[model samples]
Target chain A: MTLRRIFSFLFLLNILSCKTDSEILPSISKEDIQIKWPDYFPQPEYNFENNSLTKEGFYLGKKLFYDPILSKDSTISCGSCHQSFVAFAHADHKLSHGINNLQGIRNAPGLYNLIWQKSFFWDGGARHIELQPIAPIINPVEMGETIDHVVYKLRRNNAYKSLFNKAFMSDSITSQLLLKALAQFMGALISTNSKYDRYIQNPKMNPFTDDEKDGLALFENKCSSCHPAPLFTDGFFRNNGLDSTFIDSGRYRITNLPSDWGKFKVPSLRNVEVTYPYMHNGRFETLEQVLEHYNNGVLQSVTLDPLLRNGIALNNTEKRKIITFLKTLTDRDFIQDKRFSE
Target chain B: MQRQHTLIFIILFIFFKMKSILKVSLITLIVIIGFSSCKKDRKIDVNTEDPSIDKPDNQEKFGTVSIVFSSKAGNSDLELDSVKYTNAHGDSLTISKFKYYLSNFKLIKDDGTVYKQEESYHLINRSNGKTYTVELENVPVGTYNSLNYLLGVDSARNTSGAQTGALDPALNMFWSWNQGYIFLLFEGTSPASQSFNQALSFHIGGFTLPYNCIRSISPSFGSQNVLVTEGHNSTIFVNTDVLKMFESPHLIKFSQVSESLGGAIGSSISDNAANMFSIASIQN
Candidate 1:
């Protein structure tokens, strides 16, 4: 009887020890979270290696992107300006509208194909994709909230706690983890499968109109040097003869080089149809105005782009064809995708 | 019959003895494993520094070296917000905030042997008492004469992605718009200022060439040698003068330049900031 009792006690102890390590929720597999893009496109500048692109992390990031809790007054979110329908660019607004209805200095650029971007902002201030979101979050005219407070708020909320635990498998919610989650969502925004892409893949299946065909030829001749195909941007800073003197000082603010004055990053023209009110300061409201400026309104500046020194000579018909071509570059499938919506 | 009974009793005794031995061994194994797991967790937490550089053959022979910074304004100790101190430019200022980053520490011995501390990024804030000292652990036993450290974060960390701990972006020492760290932030109110409410803010930062503000500081021990023997902790106290920032190579009068967010003015301030520290004393 004594021997039997000892064996039973030992079995009980084993059971209790096993129960000490509680089971965590099973994480989604890595294979399910692949970033899908076209093969012709260049390699992504950011590879989600440090912060693994799990489905849970991506969803947590998508929730944070739409939630207005990031702002000081709980009013503004990243999605407040970067609407999905317009390819994530602020629709109709010249300047980004901030908390208390204040206006920002620069236009809120669309967030798409972000993994390809080496640098961010018109001045190319933010160097890394993971570090880009902090610019607008703490900007006094933007969200007007500190990152410390944002982390504190997320930690206190039980819903976010569970979401963070599910995503990172850690109880501690740090600013680093928060930024990584944001990076996952932003980097996954691959703007492929546009009409232009389909036509390039199989010209017979997706045919371009006569106007678009002519526009493509014109774009190849005039704009393709800066705005290349597949990605639509060469990612170089250029003074496109927008101004004689810079009020914003553009890339010079970051480099502190006088030669870089009045120079802004060449924006991607993937969804040029919807991402209107163009230019660094959103000076031109329409595509015609932008083309007109490039055609004849090219202002003389000390740091003017040598390509646009004399401006690209284009007639009214050629400008119309270019606009038609720009419309085909819009990815309808991307804007309507349910996975990116709140 | 008596022989049979004695044989059965012997078999039972051996069986009971073997069971007890198994139980004791199992418990011992679990205890050993438990202790080792606890030690592994501690190693992960404290020993995040690179192993190849300062990994001693025997950890028992290593000692700790603590570098404590003492902030001063001219002849007097720096008292933020209350005491009004006059600078070399004759501008009386009441400092509200003063902070900067120090990284990449190297301890040079009398024999010219250099001990490089890995992952050595420290932010020194005058307002926070906790940040005033940085304790480097597992330092090899040596007799050190002098030490070298950077006044600002290196360019590699400036371009790298989000960081944690002392280099965390939540610290407000970072410039989000410019995508670099504000190496030294000195803000206060002075009567000689032209800005709103007599405010004087100088946020010095720039990691790029020609305007790089990452200043390397090697303080002289002045005939003093820091002896780092086994298990003994050595303390090095250094004086950081705030008034030296306003004078030195360039005398920054508050009337002319009250605010320097960044760029050329910030670089000039960082140049003057290079002469702000000197070794005070050593405690072995």
Candidate 2:
């Protein structure tokens, strides 16, 4: 071959190799990322505009959430503090322990469809959902690392870099990029297949037991104001008359107000059965114990919510009914959601 | 002798042509250089060192505006040395620490086009302990006719889904549990209180109106135009008064011991500081 022909052949070879980069092209379409929900539920708060939900981003987020590689020590991942089976919240511990056995002040909350949440943390200290993980990553008592450090660590690992490149369109790995990936993962974790959701959508499909029916009534009258249906939270904070003497200072620590002294973000009761040791401080060991606090053990105060100022009066039978009702909120499909596991 | 004369004549003729060509090239190069320098001057808006004439774009110019944050009143560039803000009772108070939230920041142009930043929320904590200025970058370059900035976080983002960037809770600027943001955080000690908790920490943040302490600034550029460059050369100088930051609405020395009281007092301090800035004062 002549010199020009040889050069042309080399150029064609380069083109053939470059075509391999698009091999990992997504097989699943946008329709697969659609979240199925019950008819009774209100419109989902997370619109997924910037971090559009996709199978690729979801799997990437899931891997990062479960993988210990996101941490500094490579031992504690997001799953370490927020376990999947236990409603994503840590159990058997009052406060979440992190790298080097660093203990945080509040319990690690359950990870779920965070797109709906306007704020995060028991104190609501984190205003944005995307910024939620940064607290633990850099907190001395948590992951104990900087975002810049996290990016450096992630970039150095071929697995993470490739995963990021797959999840997002770029491999720059800025804090913004890292955060957007996490948001995609957290945003896609929708839980709408609970039994209660089914019953609400079509009573004939899956009806609630009489005991559960009674319990739900009591819950509506007593708990429904704060833990509103179907997402289970009104997405507001209140001093639920848990304790007058608070060492945690709860929401007041963030708001810097006297009225918000004992106020804490009303937690969603979706997986109340499995997410044990509940409350902001993880004080109650069981659902029955938490009921007792709401019934008879409520502390009275000036800023105490009027709804619970006198506390809900529940009899033994009523308590059983409420427990049964609370059980309906458990989403087996969510706990067993295979997409969340590594 | 005849050959030498011919050589000399040819040399002089070539030299004259070369000189004429050289002069024309020299004039052309000067004109090109002048035109290039003029274009750069328009680009380097605020730099006084640039001697070229300013031809500002018809659209409002936007550039990075940064305030060097500091704790000491005189330590940084955001400090205000004077003030006057009256309460419902018509009493003026001196604010020791002026702390407030700066949210929903936008730069409106002469044509009524508004450019709002993505994450415009900021808790400007200033007082004796805070004079450090914050730098806002990536502003679109143009000649701004007026500026309208919010003193507190906007109501839309105040209650919305997941947010990133400066609005991150990791910065400690967010009130993690309250389900609301702390727009402004002013912290410092008082002469009246000797105890450790004697220091006042004012966290003034209310997105809703009526209690909204947000102030909009419209400074007069006078005869000159407010220049905005694409690079790091543009500037907006704000003259902050230290005295106006203290003893406002609520006495700084007395109310500074409490967190909320200090926040209320910060209203006056912040309002005064807002007046310290002018578009004409901005210089390179």
- Highest lDDT against the true fold, candidate: 1
Best by TM-score: 1
Where model 1 places Cα greater than 4 Å from the true spot, the runs are A1-32, B1-56
Model 2, residue B184: distance off in Å is 7.8
Per-candidate DockQ values are 0.36, 0.11
Interface RMSD per candidate: 5.5, 13.0
**lDDT, candidate 2, A1-342, per-residue tens:** 643354344434433433343333433345556665666767665676676667777777777777776677888888888877877888677789988897888877787767678778887777666667777776777777766677777788888778777777675666666776777778777777778888887889799998888888888987898988878998888888877788878877655578778888888999888887788888888889988888899898877888887888888888888899989988898888777755
* Candidate 1: residue A129 lDDT (0-100): 92
lDDT (Cα, tens digit) per residue for candidate 1, span A1-342: 565465445444544443342222244455645688878998888988678788989989999999988999999999999999888989988899889998999998888999999999999999999999999999999999999999999999999999998888889999988998899889888889899999999999889999999999999999999999889999999999988987999999888899999999999999889998899888889999999999999999999999999999999999999999999999998888788866
CAPRI band for model 2: incorrect
Candidate 1's docking class is acceptable
The parts of candidate 2 lying over 4 Å away from their true place are A1-33, B1-215, B220-269, B275-284
